[model samples]
Target: MPTYAIGDIQGCELELQRLLERLKFDPAADRLWFTGDLVNRGPGSLGVLRLVHSLDACAIVVLGNHDLHLLALAAGNERHARKSTLDEVLSAPDRDELLHWLRHRPLLHHDAAKGYTLIHAGLAPQWTLGVAQTLARELEETLRGAHWQDFLLAMYGDQPERWRPDLTGIERLRFITNALTRLRYCTTDGALALKEKRPLASAPKGLVPWFQCPGRKSRDARIIFGHWSALGYWDQDNVWGIDSGCLWGGNLTAVRVRKSKPIEPVHLPCEGYLTPGESGD
Candidate 1:
């Protein structure tokens, strides 16, 4: 029962299929974990959604910023859909069902038995595993509640850049959302630099990759995340980043997670869909 944690698909259904074939995946015995961004910015958003949604029993997904944007668009937030490639999904006959499933997907998943935690992006430097899980559930409940659309409408923003226990209302939720889905770099003090998406070598002064922040509370736990394709495949500092920029013609990557053995990563080259620098999450 091998579990594979895959990088951001970004709507690359064909690449996903090829990679699964390469892994010799047996859905009944193998579990697939996606770091999210399962849709948007590629040619096959609809197909990708259908395929993953069909494998609900064995597939685990955390929501990426792009995934949230897709939900927002479906909830009538059209202004942000200018560059979106989700029309096919929106118009599909099963659109509601797919979105419903997506809406219920988690923001974070932790398997204590496997000793691994999964998230779409970075966590606040101040969060321990328990804190991260609690915050995740807070937003998860809101997304699953009756007013989820209202939450979506108010979800866009970068304010309240730092996390605080006393934070309340939308401010608290937005911070939680950004930290879990949009975070990459931040000051050691935990102030998110969400606009800085470049690789580590080019990171601006005073900013460090969230996982690398000194004395990070979650540093002792193994975390798997994506949403930083610019950082490529990272495997250091108690974290693994597998988003290899598949949407930008880079390889789609996956790593086999084992309880006691070294993890192994596999990659499949992707045909260029959108060139680098056109846009990013």
Candidate 2:
């Protein structure tokens, strides 16, 4: 099967459509793996959600930070939605169904046959593939269960920036969520520096991109992620980052992946929907 991994859409629905056209996407045979942040920042978030949700079995998505924020808003966490461009999604007639579908999406997707894992952002340097999968399932179950609203309530925070096996309750889940969604830089000892969103070269002292940190446990497994538009389309250290800043007037990008072969980026320039600093991802 032909598989394509696409970057953060961030409400650039038209760019998404055009990129799909460029790939000659065939719903019958081509599989799409989306690197999340499906809504927010750009215009047409509602349209983007509808289109991706309609893809059904042809697509697999991992939730990004903005996606989680949307769920929080859907659950009445309005404070975080103040600067969001997701009003259209909230007001849509099919809001409940769409939100329900989105909330249930996984935080991480692994394709064992292809030897690549998909996530919205980078994993913690401490987690092996097995441990990462286990952590992902923990959050996935909470998001899909009866107490999902509670999860959304406790989901927003940046505390306990480091991961530990003994960490319990919301602190543990929060760290896992941040590492998988909002992560950018980390200290030498693997303490997450979530606030540092600058490019790798300008990263604060003693910090490096999460993938470049030494002694990473999942280094042997390939990781494909988005959520770092500033990092652009990076392919090093067995990690592939495809977020090309579509919401900020950069191109929407996708990489065609075939087992044991180098991936190639397919891109189309976006007619930007929002300027940088106007909204947060």
Candidate 3:
């Protein structure tokens, strides 16, 4: 089957439709691997959610930071509710269904057959592919279980910036969540530099994009990720980043992923909804 890994939609439904059309996507035969951030910042998060959810088995999505923010707001986090463009989703007639669907989404996806791992952001420098899978499942099952709301409430911190095998409870989960869905730059020793959202050339002292750290354990694995719009559709070494800043009037991108073929991005330009410096979700 033909599979397309798409960049962060960020609620750009019109552009998403256009991009799919450009790819000549057939839901019946082709599969879509969405790079998360399906809602927020754009003009049509509600529309985008309904469309993607309706696709059912044709699409697979890993949760993004913005997606988690929507869940936090739905779970009564007033802080996120204030500046969010997620009002449409929160007030939709099908709101519960949508949020329920979103919460159950994975933090990471790995296809052993294709030798590709899909995450909303980059992996930790210390995690091997096997450890990454185990940690992803720990969080995945928590999100899908009865203690989910409790987990959501505890999932927001940036503490324990570096992963330690000795870390336990929510602290461990939080670190894993940040690494998988929110990471960008990290220090050489793998400390999370979550606040450094600048472009690569402007990287703060001692920090490098997660994928560039020397001797990283997952360096040999093929990774497809989103969430660093500043990096913008990067393809380097074994990593491919497809988030092209659609909300900032950049392109909505998609790349064909196959075991044998070369990967190339197909983009649809967006009539940006948020100006630079605005909150994305």
Candidate 4:
């Protein structure tokens, strides 16, 4: 059985089909670990969300920032639609079911037997893989709990600028969302600079990409993430970035966990996105 860990699909559903065909993926034999943001940017947000929801047994997904935003917008946390990419998802006939599935997705997934951990973005500098997973569990449970709407309400900001386990309510949820999904740069003091999605040297005066930060807690674990399309295909010993910006006229990317260093990536042409908005990579 071949398990393929794919980067952010972000509403590019047909590419997923083509890539799977290239790999000869059998739903019964192969499993898929998605790094999240399965619906957004691209044109098939509704279809992708609906399909992933049905692939419950064969697919595992972590919640990406866009995914969280979709939940918040769906639950009426955001008054107006944030962007054009999400309008389709919000207005879909089965919006409720799609939002339910998205909100209930996990924050992180780790396969010990396979030696790879999957997150929508990358990990924080101060957290070990174990600690990251622990925090992820808290957020996942909170999202899945009855008061999930309350969490969604507080899930949109980046005010605190740090992490504290004692944080309750929406502040905690927001932090988790950023750290696990929207994260890109970090401060020298280990603060999250979620707004900047740019790469290392071009980042602000005092920021480094979280995965490259020295003394990073989750640095030891092999991470597979799909958020930074600009980061492209960084291949360090422990981190594998798979976002090739398929929605932005780039090719879809997928990496086999066990075969991280292998032949050319199976590329699929982009179906293009609905709009040319700011990329979440």
Candidate 5:
């Protein structure tokens, strides 16, 4: 079976549909992997959610920051930001069902046989693949458990900039969530520089892309991630960054992933949704 790992959809359902058509996606014979950010800041988040939710059997999704934000809003822990395009989803008749499904999605997915690890954003330099998986589950259990609301309420923060085994409680969980869903740059010593969002060439001298941090523990694992539209469609050093700025009128990308062959990326152009120079996830 062919497997396609797609970048952030961000609610651009029409583009998603066209891209799937371009690939001639056959649900019975092919698999789809989403890099997350499947909703928000686009015109069709409601439609996107329903469509992906309907394809549950054939689609694998890791939660993105936007996805988590939606859950927080639904749980009444956050107010919609000024550019929020999630009202449709929040008001949808099937909102509860959709949110439930999204909340249960994993933060990371690793296919040992295929040698691919998927996440919505970057991993901390301190975590090996095994360690990342274990940490993911710790937060996953909380999101899927009864106190999910409390977790969401406490989720927003930039503290605990580095990881330590001794870290416990909400601090630990927030770090995990930020590492897997918001990380972009970090110091050589593994302190997350969450504010750095510029492209590689323009990055400040001291910050290195998380994947390039010296002695990264997950260096040996092949990782696929999104949430860095500024970095766009990168492929190097055992990692793939495929966000491609779909929400900003760049392209929606999908890469055919194979165990022993060069992956092929397919791109579909998008009409600009939000104007340029606006802040977005």
Candidate 6:
């Protein structure tokens, strides 16, 4: 059974279909690992969500920032961002089902056999494969509860510029969500810098990519993630970034995780949105 790890869909539904066709994906014989951002920023958010939700095949999906934003907005905590492209989903008849399914999705997934860990963004430098899974559970439990909106409301911001084990209550939970979904560069001390989504070379002085932190303790494990569209389809054998930015007219990409050195991608071109004279369908 082959496993394909796909990048951020960002609501590019037609693009997703093209990608699967290119890969010759067989639902009955293969597995799909989605790096999340499955909705928003394209013309087909509702369609993409519906398709993935009904796959019935084995799939591992972690929550991306766009996915989380939809959850918070659905819960009436925040308005959709001006830059958001989620109107189709917001108006969908099955929006409730989609939102709930997303909330309960895992924050990180690990496969011992393949030595692959998948998250929306990437792991913190300090977390072991063990500690990352533990904290993911801590946040996941609250997300599955009534207090979820409260946690989402508190999930923004980049204060404290450092991580501390003593961080309690919503603060700690919020930190985990941000790190797993929105994180890019971090202070030398492991504090997340969620606002900067630029490429690695352009980061502010003293800040380091979360995966490249000094004395990186967890870099030993292979990780696959999608975020930071700036990073594009970069593959480092052990670290795979599949976020090729379909919403920005880049290709949709996926990688077979169990492969050996120099990972290669199964990629697809972006599909056009409905033009003024054409129907979206």
Q: Each prediction's TM-score against the native? A: 0.98, 0.98, 0.97, 0.91, 0.98, 0.91
**How far does residue 168 in candidate 1 sit from its true spot (Å)?**
0.8
For residues 195-249, could you state the per-residue lDDT of candidate 3 as single tens digits? 7788888888898999998778999999999998888888887999999998898
lDDT of 2 by residue, 99-125 (tens): 999988999999988889999998999
Which 10-residue window in model 1 sums to the lowest lDDT?
74-83
Candidate 1 has which clashing residue pairs, if any? none
What value does the lDDT take at residue 173 in candidate 6?
A: 80
Q: What digit string (tens of lDDT, one per residue) describes model 5 on residues 1-281?
A: 99999999999999999999999999999999999999998889999999999997899999999999999888886654565789899988999999999999999999888899999999999899999999999999999999999999889888899999999999999999999999999997899999878899999988999999999999999999999998989999799999999889999999998999988999898886876568645
Worst 10-residue lDDT window, candidate 3: 75-84
Off by over 4 Å in 6: 259-262, 271-281
**Reference-based TM-score, model 4:** 0.91
Give a tens-digit lDDT track for model 4, residues 1-281. Answer: 77877877888888887888887888888888888888777878788888878887899988887788788786668643556478877777887877777777888998898778889887778788898998899898988889888877767767667877687767776787788988888887888988887655577788888887778877668888888877777777478788877887776887766644452355676756643445344
lDDT of each: 0.93, 0.90, 0.89, 0.78, 0.92, 0.80
By summed lDDT, which 10 consecutive residues of candidate 6 come out lowest?
A: 272-281
- Candidate 3's displacement at residue 273, Å, is 0.8
True lDDT of residue 2, candidate 5: 96
Candidates 4 and 5 compared: the better one by lDDT is 5
- What's the residue-level lDDT of 34 in candidate 6? 97
Going through the candidates in order, what is the number of backbone clashes in each?
Answer: 0, 0, 0, 0, 0, 0
Q: Estimate candidate 2's alpha-carbon lDDT, on a 0 to 1 scale.
A: 0.90
Stretches off by above 4 angstroms in model 3 are none
Q: What ranking of all candidate models by TM-score puts the best one first? A: 1, 5, 2, 3, 6, 4
lDDT of 1: 0.93
Ranking by lDDT, best first?
1, 5, 2, 3, 6, 4
Model 3 lDDT, full chain set: 0.89
Candidate number with the higher lDDT (1 or 3): 1
Candidate 4 residue pairs in backbone clash: none
| Error at 100, model 3, angstroms | 1.6
